[model samples]
Target: MSAGEELRARLAVALTRARDRSAALTECVDETELVAQHSPLMSPLVWDLAHIGNQEELWLVRDVGGREPVRRDIDELYDAFRHPRAARPALPLLDPDEARGYVAQVRDKVWEVLDRAPLRGRRLERDGFAFAMIAQHEQQHDETMLATHQLRSGPAVLTAPPPPSPSWPPAVGAEVVVPAGEFTMGTSTDPWALDNERPAHRVALPAFAIDAAPVTNGQFLEFLDDGGYRRPELWSARGWEHRQSATLAAPQFWERDGAGNWWRRVFGVLAPLPPASPVVHVSYFEAQAYARWAGRRLPTEAEWEKAARWDPRTGESRRFPWGEGEPDSGHANLGQRHLEPAAVGAYPAGRSPLGVGQLIGDVWEWTSSDFQPYPGFSAFPYREYSEVFFGGDYKVLRGGSFGTDPVACRGTFRNWDLPIRRQIFAGFRCARDVVGA
Candidate 1:
């Protein structure tokens, strides 16, 4: 195949992968469940179903293909900025069957555009960026719908095999030192990287230590045992206030039996907590308090990126933690292959040059840095995607989660959310400064 043909083939596969996953997520439930707002934080599954199609129609059929809008009447109904998740149910939305049909129609138009549209020239078409962007957007919403499934109170409807056992356990309290120096952060060459992660720049830093693997459920249980939540000193003032108001005790979805043993609900299946797996469904406040109790801090975005991407041996950065290679099942727990995080040290192949394991998948790791633009950032296509969300109100998260699709994730991939959001799959690893290095 020619180079352009190859690009089109990859884009088609990415789009198909995203759509298949979306079907799996939304097809398991009945229409009532699809229309019900499982949580105030998440849109109804049907809304997401239609929203995905709407976005595809807007970007691919209308914008890129230069075609008349497909169902422009419903554009405002699906516009995320126009309505909050809590209010979506009240608005007239396409039913499950209608939504499925609508997305299928939109996709038909997309494939027509993909077959003939020049993959080069215009900025949107350059390197097939627009197609990739839409695919990523759909996968992101699929993840959101997966979260809604997790929040739904029902019998277990989704199932997957457990993640593989680690070849060897990650040592207790293991950390890898990133020596003081400069390393390139973000990316300028990544054709599909979103605006927030653009314009690669060098970042200088002093010596510091980061966890070799993400903190596991066993370690976090220790924090809970020691009154980690009750002690005010262990939390920031704002964190403490939110903790008290939200009645934060354990990670969301956790339940304590009369025997006082902790169990958690995963996709509607109640099971005992796995000590070795990285803890998920935690908020930034909870992670921060846990770090404080452990006498460490959350890694900043730059610190996390450097640890995940920098190659000390060669004085350069790698595309992924292990190297410049696309992720596979053995490399990381991604793409909903497993519904939960694998045990730390499970994917030794995925470790960075500095030996930071599980950095690419499992859980979205919270960093100390607030969501902000990198130096020389500029919005393309639209500003609502990233520019509107840049501020201190949101905290930066690096690395993708088990729910994150590969097309939407990379070392330079940036995810952010309000600090108190715990419904999403999020976790953290601790870091400490080295005074003299």
Candidate 2:
């Protein structure tokens, strides 16, 4: 088939996927309902949905291409990025049906124009890339919205977890004794990575004993029982402040019932906390606190990458704990059933050379390092992604969440956010500088 036909086919599939996502999210986001409190992260369903429409339609189809938008009237309707949240109300907006129509119109136009069009035009790729980016943006918001709906409101659907994941890595209990080595950390890329992952650098390190598995809820519960939260000495000042302010009694989704039984929200369903499951939805603050409480700390980004580094010639150690490939059901709780968080240790094949449980995708492990750009780092085409936050407030987060796009989980892909945010699908695994045996 010609490149043009291929583009259409690809575009068709992509649009269909986005549309499917909208349908899947229908149960999660109800425009008529009041926005939940835990979701201070977003403006409103209308705002977000409309923003998607505007971004997909106007930003990609017309503006970036130097063409006029199809709907002149809707140009500023939901342009929340350019028109900030404070200014969002001033612009006329669309209801769900209208928003969908706007999205469809843009999607149709994008497909039509690109079908037989030149890929060489700066206008097309520039605009097309925007849509690609917009799609990613939507996905990020989608997971957060789901998390907020459950945390701030109530569980979307109450059901038992589907059951332990049927798939498991072949080497159930393998060990990757990663040698102590110095390596560059953070995303060392000239290409576009989020600001948090930029300014990669070389760091020296000594040997350390690294865990092959993520710290499970069962393990973390022990720390909690041992006064993980109450002990001020175990927390950073910032972390303590967050704990006291939120009055956090446990991990974000965990609840202690009248009977004192522990339950956790797993993909809109509440069930008894799985003993072997990796504790998820814990924020950076909480992760830090837990690490200190356990006499450990979050791994440095350097330590993480060095251990996972692969030397193909040596075959000595696996660079990717699960081998050089994308994650599947056998590797991590990433793109698959979409029903629930799998049990920790469910993906043995995906384990790093060192024995780590659920390192790749079950949850986003919080790292101790502050989110900062690497030395000699420069901004990407979009300046806002990395340059704005170089002052060092954000914290580095690692691994990938269950629903994170596999392509987005590259080792260099840096994720950062406020420490107190526990409503997202982030979780942490503990690390420490090597101590005397």
Query: How would you encode candidate 1's per-residue C-alpha lDDT over 1-437 as one tens digit per residue?
Result: 99989999999999999999999998898888999998899999999989999999999999889999879999999999999999999999999999999999999999999999898899999999999999999999999998999999987789899999997577987999999999999999989998899989999999999999999999999999999989999999999999999999999988999999999999999999999999999999999999999999999999999999999999998889988889999889899999999999899999999888999989999999999999899998899999999875999999999999999999999999999999999999999999787
Per-candidate local distance difference test: 0.94, 0.62
lDDT of 2 by residue, 342-421 (tens): 66657766755455567677677777777776777776436676677666678877777776665456566667777887
Candidate 2 C-alpha RMSD relative to the actual structure: 4.2
Question: Model 1: residues >4 Å from true position, as ranges?
Answer: none
User: Would you give me the overall lDDT of model 2?
Assistant: 0.62
Model 1's lDDT to the true fold? 0.94
Clashes of 2: 16
TM-score of every candidate relative to the true structure? 0.99, 0.82
- In model 1, pairs of residues that clash are none
Best by TM-score: 1
Model 2's TM-score against the true structure: 0.82
lDDT of 2 at 341: 63
Error of 2 at 367 (Å): 0.6
